[model samples]
Target: MSLFSQAFRPVGSTRADPVLVALWVALILVAVIWIAPFVFIVFTSLKTNTAVMGETAFALPTDPAFSNYAKAWARGNFSVTAFNGVLITFVKVPLGVFLSAMAAYALARVPMRGRRVLFLLCVFGTMIPFQVMLAPIFKQVNAFGLINSYPGIVLPYLAFGVPYQVFILYGFFSAVPKELSEAARIDGASHFTIFRRIFLPVSLPALSALFVLDFVATWNEFAMALVILQDPQKWTLPLGLMAFQSQFQRDYGQLNAAIVMTVLPAAIVYLMFQRYFVAGLTTGAVKE
Candidate 1:
């Protein structure tokens, strides 16, 4: 059942269920709690630094300073950093998802030795914290003279991102009926053809969902970009935001404006893929 239907579904014939009412209340409370910071940020972004510092955080701006966004855009060098962020996110996320999807397909459909062990190892990799691998990743990237380059950052992102992508896609892929593969094979469809034409097409929801998630993660990635991209010119949005914060520490208005700018793209991407997200996540949850 759809969430809306479930949420409003009446018990018996007369009145609302107390349990459902309580759940609705709890959900509203959680939504408010989650959105409160964003609301504060928006309000602060429109206020003067004086107003931001003097007034309560939740206070509405007495005099809305729309120029704060202009100042932030210019001072934050958002044009350049936004370009870099877009480049990295667009380049890294789709490529990572595609590669991970192929890996997942192999593990799911292909006959291979120790596939279970390999899948287990991939799952194990997700457990290893990125911090633990940072030094070694930096060392390797530096050894290859990739510091401050896009590849340096993208490679690490793929490495860290793949395990989880595979974990998700593997379950989705495995759940596909084997008869489909058999039928495809009987029609002389190659494994690559089957994967590209059949599997990928049917997995649109999962792929779209992964793309949105990975796009957001890649766009907001900080530590890896910080370590790999030393040059200011190559800094992504998160790193640029950090620099913006440091340079404009006392300018709360501009700082919050910069934050809103940084968050906007990810939010846009999420909304674009919102329809597929819940379905993708619950793809294999129940078997008929």
Candidate 2:
């Protein structure tokens, strides 16, 4: 224990060292529980298919088989699927962010009669089960002749994505200081210019956080892509990964390798934006 901490602590109270030691032990245990599955996935990916399917599912294989990753990559057509996933995430995330930010700002800040009612209506849509909307959504997309097209797929993701994005950002925007907006107005900056320059710039950390989440959601989305994308060329990694499982003869090693490959991009993306998840309490921020 540090001398300062010991001096300050009361005699009857537990020492900070024992408490800290116990807390670290608990955290390490939880971390191990969380990471064990991923560790097993990597271990199994490196095992041969026969070894993976053997009696000892949990036991590490006798020899590592790194070649399984190559086989999975080739057989899964991972290159094309990964490219498609990247393209989809790239298009959907920025578009969703802009649309949601503008809409949320308008809802939160724009003065209009019945604005509360409209905001409530928008929030109500999020409560409606997505499965219930699927039929009508599909019909509308079909009527528009967008089925089997990228727009067909991307638009629905935007539709679903925007509601939740707005829900979060509206709360954030409402919490913004009104004085800044008023000041910008006095400076002759139009609402659009102020939103683009002043309000949005201050939202960097939140925006970065939202982008990573949306990008990962778009990248990993499976059920929607399965229905919308019938063309083999347009198939995303998630759908293609499904194909890998079905087409292969229950090759668990290859499946594990593909699973690992499929997860890498989203993991990297989250790590990049994870900084924003930390809350900061800087001085000079207003209550409203």
Candidate 3:
């Protein structure tokens, strides 16, 4: 059953609450509102430019133009940009998650000195906005001779991705039973072994959630990528898509098609990992 059905379904003699039903209706309405733009964009993308301009903005195309995607890809240089996005996201997400998990595990489970300070530093990082550091980061990347390179864009992602990830994983780690770690230690397991064998298996949901979240965030991030990557060949999808617009005229069809292409990967990633995303969010939210 759907979430709304499951939420409202009466278990026995009692009818569903009127308020609950009202809330459900409101939720559905809100969802429709939220998704309307995407639906319009998809339909508009399939239409010819002349049809889009001449016809009612939301009307269905008389003849669909599937070639819009190919035209967008060619004009936007998305073949290169998409590959860059994939490479950066793939490289950054796993490394950031692993390192963040290690840091979280240490803060949550280990009796190491200054753990509190380190954890506090991580927390502080999460509070700071990325835009505040953008100029400095760009200069640092340039200083390190990483400008317009994969590593230039990727390094900042790793740095910025970690604190938030650590914040998420720390809650999950802290929820783990201390006895499990103690038992592993008694079995002559090192900290690495305990983390590898004990915490990791139990944290799959959170990991998968972070994987999806990080993939989407990294894939969509525009400002940082724009600054660090100066070359058109190194541009990510968002920058590539912006190429569809010039000062005088915008190719709405091509622009919309590029938007759809950019949205597809993140949608696919979320769908693949969605089973874990909800559970992960709720599981570590309350300490038992």
Candidate 4:
């Protein structure tokens, strides 16, 4: 049943579902709690250093000196960080999603000779933690002298994100009705065309969700970026933001301001894709 009743279906005519309302309230409350830190960060970011540390950490700033944002941009080099982040996200998301979708489509739909083995391989690939494998991967990159470079960062992002991406896409594609795919085949569409026209467009919502997820994950990724990227010039925002902490007993105001700056792009992206994000998650939740 639809969460909301249709106009034809009289208002308050469906099940009185008090439990659902209660659940909704609970979820909203939880979301508020989760988002509180962000709110605090934003509030502090708009305050001056004196205000942030003064008797106003939790209270509103007297002047609300929003220039802290510009200070953060200038001091933390968040522009460069955001630029690098965008570069990595653009390169990784499409490539990751496409590769994963293709892999998933084949595993789920095709009757290949070794299809079961391939599925098992994909599952096994996701089982190993990236940290365990990081040393060897870094060694290989070092051998290629890709350390501290864009490719060094990007290659690992793709490699790590691929397994989960494939897993999700595989399930989604498998849930597609075979009859529709067969009709496309009978209509003389090639496999590529069928997938491109039929499946890809239908899965737009899920793709949007994946894009937001992959972008955020790649953007905020700190561990690998820290280990692989050694040059201060190439440091991503997560690492760059850390510099504010270690210098002179920590400037919480600038740190918070830098954090707010770092968060803006991802927040803007999420807002833009929110419609798709909700649809994607809900649709992806639907069982076969």
Candidate 5:
């Protein structure tokens, strides 16, 4: 019998394996535990403030207040904030990934003195805490007259984001076979051409994974945005959510609705890139 069949079969008689049954039960319990809070949030978003205060936390809403979303959207000024969030995330994430990919390619493939040192420096950057650089970064940005603008937030995002992206892309790029580049070089392909035509096309899995991760990080980033974007018009989703909570602190339904809206984009991006994400992380792990 196949291993799958044997696993499901009785151990020695008519009864199923107790160990397998226990494992399955444990998995189900863990799944429920993880999902319970999200379920509560969704249910609460559909409830009125009166209903929320009067009813049990887990009880289904007797009268769902779908207008909560509309109210939250208007009161929170989400239209402006959501646009700002999308603009920053979409611009920063892809540009950062592309720049990191190029740096990784140079580190992995180019024959240069001190390449190892440079790569190590980039890796070391990832170890430093953002909190440590906050004051210095703010001063520099202000000196450059970038505060209260898109570039103010984006420049820092790119700077901080590139190190981790380079670390990930470097591993994947190193795993690529040298033969492909060698063959292209023999055909008179320039280094840039080889990278654009061959390396980039093959590195989609890693790139997509990075895109999703960076998208989520940039989308939800609040501290840097708060520090740099002084204008309420330039606020991102996270900032908008905080403002929404403060203004509607007593309105549980509208607050939860705003929370759900803020979370939805990142969740959608993850689901879209879910297939490549796992493969990308594992691809270079056991390189030959």
Candidate 6:
């Protein structure tokens, strides 16, 4: 039998299984729909501006121009901007996760007055949209002379990052058996020691997941970065991509190249941590 027939046909049968064939066809269609734009961007990045705008936007580049990436990188000042993004992501994500984890541990493990109220307040903070806080945050940043600086941007990232991380970690910490902590406590382990040695190690999957998430969110964030980072030197990759696109508005190839560059780092970061992310997500799905 031909490969096509074999693929669509059920074993021990001369004809295709209608249900399997339909499902396979639907999957292929969805896959194409999902991947079409990325494929277009790759093709477009190789074509000239005229070709991109011309009748053959979907056509393969007849005269592939590979220099667009080099040109976009140079024009976009991506080296510095990408580095700035990495720096900000590296600094903020760890701090945010650590702080959030600590808060979560206390909320989950410690008995305190008004704990429910405090925990609900943290959850409530997440509901307040970032857009609503923009004006007030900008004002506060300016008042504290944090505007036009890295700390200014980093601090807000941490603040916004903490609540969600805490919420997630809180659940994980809660799910941990209290018997372990009790055993360690009977051995004279301090709260800090127990947390540092026990809770953190066991929560690696969740922490890894949160780290990946916060890193991407901080990296792609544009509105606050644009507002606070006035200097061109401190612009992150997303801001740099926007500025590059505007400056080379007519150069679709360059624009697409810049976009590809902007996307690559985040994609790589996600891929690197994807295993842990998926594991962490499934950690709490079933009872032990």
lDDT of 1 at 3: 61
The lDDT for every candidate, in the order shown, is 0.91, 0.83, 0.87, 0.80, 0.91, 0.88
Model 2 TM-score on a 0 to 1 scale: 0.86
Q: By the lDDT metric, which is better: model 3 or model 5?
A: 5
lDDT of 1 at 37: 97
For candidate 4, give the lDDT.
0.80
TM-score of each: 0.94, 0.86, 0.94, 0.88, 0.92, 0.88
**Candidate 4: segments with Cα more than 4 A from true spot:** 1-21, 284-288
Per-residue accuracy of model 4 over 118-191 as CA lDDT, tens digit each? 77877888898888888988898899999989999888888878888878888888888899899988999888
Off by over 4 Å in 2: 1-14, 17-26, 53-63, 280-288
**TM match of model 4 to true structure:** 0.88
**Model 1: runs farther than 4 Å from truth?**
1-11
Whole-model lDDT, model 5: 0.91
RMSD of each: 2.8, 4.0, 2.5, 4.0, 3.1, 3.3
TM-score of 1: 0.94
- 1-288 in candidate 2: lDDT tens per residue? 365456545578755556655666688799999999998988888887778877365687779888889999999898988888988889999999999999888888888888788778778867877667777878898899998888998999998888888887788888888999989899998889989987798776677778988888899998788777888888999999988988884787888999999999899988877776433222124553
Candidate 6 lDDT score at position 214: 86
Write candidate 5's Cα lDDT for 139-222 as tens digits: 999999999999999999999999999998898888788999999999999989999999999999899889988998899998
* lDDT value, residue 170 of candidate 6: 87
On the 0 to 100 scale, the lDDT of residue 241 in model 5 is: 96
Assess the local accuracy of residue 168 in candidate 2 as a C-alpha lDDT between 0 and 100: 77
Worst lDDT 10-window in candidate 2? 277-286
